[model samples]
Target: MTQKKRIVIKIGSSSLTSLHGEISRRKLKRIAEEVVELKEEGHEVLLVSSGAVAAGYRKLGCVERPTALTEKQAAASIGQGLLMEAYSEYFLSHGYVASQILITRTDFSEEKRYKNARNTLKILLDRGIIPIVNENDTVTIDRLKFGDNDTLSAKVAGLVDADQLIILSDIDGLYDSDPRKNPNAELVRDVKEITPEIEASAGDPGSAAGTGGMKSKIEAFKITMASGIHAFLGKAGVRGLLLDAANGTASGTYFTPAEKTLDSRKQWIAFNSGPEGTVTVDQNAKNVLTAHTGELQAEHVISVSGRFKNGAVVRLKDENEEEIGLGIINYSSEQLQHFRELDEEAKAIVDSEGLVCRIDVPLPATI
Candidate 1:
């Protein structure tokens, strides 16, 4: 019997839209069928779908994709409902219920909301319902946008502790060079790390209907790898591709990290909770934090930057101005500043449990 695992599947806009740039029912049907198969085989699946603006713009009377933010948001407002309707109809026909989740960058940035999302998704998966996630594009401003669903999928995968993340795009896999520019470029089969060479080879977005390109996909993989979730990237609409990916037999670029997986709190601090401020520590404090010897005391801090509330994620920097790591500050920036004037015995600050180090690793761009 195959082991039951929670999987997060990301479908790109190019995959869901037709040549004329509208939501294709045939494509949606195929995806629904594949997900049904996975459910029958005893795996939990959550989908991150991108095509809101692509599916809705033409219906909004635009000949091409809207360039203005409000126009695009208007299109998304119309399309999101239609998209969910199609998914719900298709999944229900196969005896599975589909649920919609509209997410924002702020949802993940706040600790309580982040955990709430996880719990909700967990409940859906546990009850055998498929959760379809999309960015809350209609209400989100440009600054608060997730940028693309690729990054959103990775964050969602990490949020639910998914066993695998399958990203289906127009391209089959990562190439050694930009295939459009170089005909001799070869597909990379397995990636242990997102090295500089790999980053250099990734090109811009390939489709007019899609916002995320290979570069964004690579960024997504960085988050998955760091979270220790295996990820696969391949062409959409391939026969049995979803099942093949779950079984580790898919023809695509596979990403697996060499390091141990991060815990849930660490995953949040590393990828989601946006650091509210910076705190520079002395050499002794840095040494203690890095070595896991003790907590960061107020007397050990040289300076604090930015205003932040207590329990906010803050960047920890060293005396030389290099970032050491991030930690949940036990005191507000104002409190820390006041405590600087207090004696050492009265200045206990961030607890060790709230601290996370290993700042040298390449974190996801969304962080």
Candidate 2:
């Protein structure tokens, strides 16, 4: 028997829509059936699907996908419902229940809200219900948006600590070069580390229906791999594609996870939380922070910039003003400055666990 796994499937707009920009029922049904089979096989599944704009633009009386932000948001309001209805209908036919989860980037930025979202997903997945996730476009401003479903899916996979993330796109896999222009471009089937060369090979989006291109896909993989989750990227609608992906038999790009993964708290601090202030440390301070050997002493803090409350995430920079890492600061900006004038015994110490280094994350530490 195959071992049960938790999988996050990200279906792109192009994967679920016709070339004319309308959602295709035939394609949706096929995808739903595959998801049902995965569930029957005891694999827990979550879907971060992108099709709201494509499905609703026509209903909004737009001859094509809208370019204005308000128009796009309006289209999403209409399409989100229709997309869920189709998913629920198909899943219900198979005796499975499907639920909708709409989110904006703001939801993840706040720690309490982030945890609440995770807990909710835990309940749904525990009860054998399939959760359909998407960006809440109707109210999301550009500044607070996740940008694309590709990145959102990765963050969701990390949030749930899923066993694998399967991203279905118009393209089958990453290529060594631009296949459209290079007749001999080769598909990269297995990727353990994303090198500069691999990054250079990635290009712009190929489908007019989708927002993310190969670049965003690579960025998504970085998030998943950092969280110790394996991932697959492939063309959607291939027969048994989801199953093959879960079984590790798919003909597409595969990403291997790092040996060590970030813990829940650090994962959030590293990927989700936004930094509010900046701290500049001397070389000695940088060394101590990176070594994970001790707490950050007040004497080492050369300067603090920006006003932030204590316990906020702060960007740490070195004497030369190069960014070194991020940390949950122990002191407010004013407090940090005030402590510099205090006696050695009265100084505040930022604990080792609060710091996150730039080169690689330290083991369970905060800077």
Which stretches in model 2 have alpha-carbon errors above 4 Å? 341-367
Quote the RMSD, in angstroms, for model 1: 3.0
For candidate 2, list the clashing residue pairs, or say none. 353-365, 353-366, 354-366, 354-367, 355-366, 355-367
What root-mean-square deviation over C-alphas does model 2 reach? Answer: 3.2
**Superposition error at 217 for model 2 (Å):** 0.6
Score candidate 1 by lDDT. 0.87
**Residue-by-residue lDDT tens digits, candidate 1, 2-51:** 88889999999888888887899999999989999999999999999999
- Cα lDDT tens digits, model 2, 136-204, are 999898999888999999999989989999999988899999888898999999999888898899899
Winner by TM-score:
2
RMSD of each: 3.0, 3.2
TM-score of each: 0.93, 0.94
List clashing residue pairs in candidate 1.
none
Q: Candidate 2: lDDT of 333?
A: 87
After superposition, the stretches of candidate 1 with alpha carbons farther than 4 Å from their true spots are 342-367
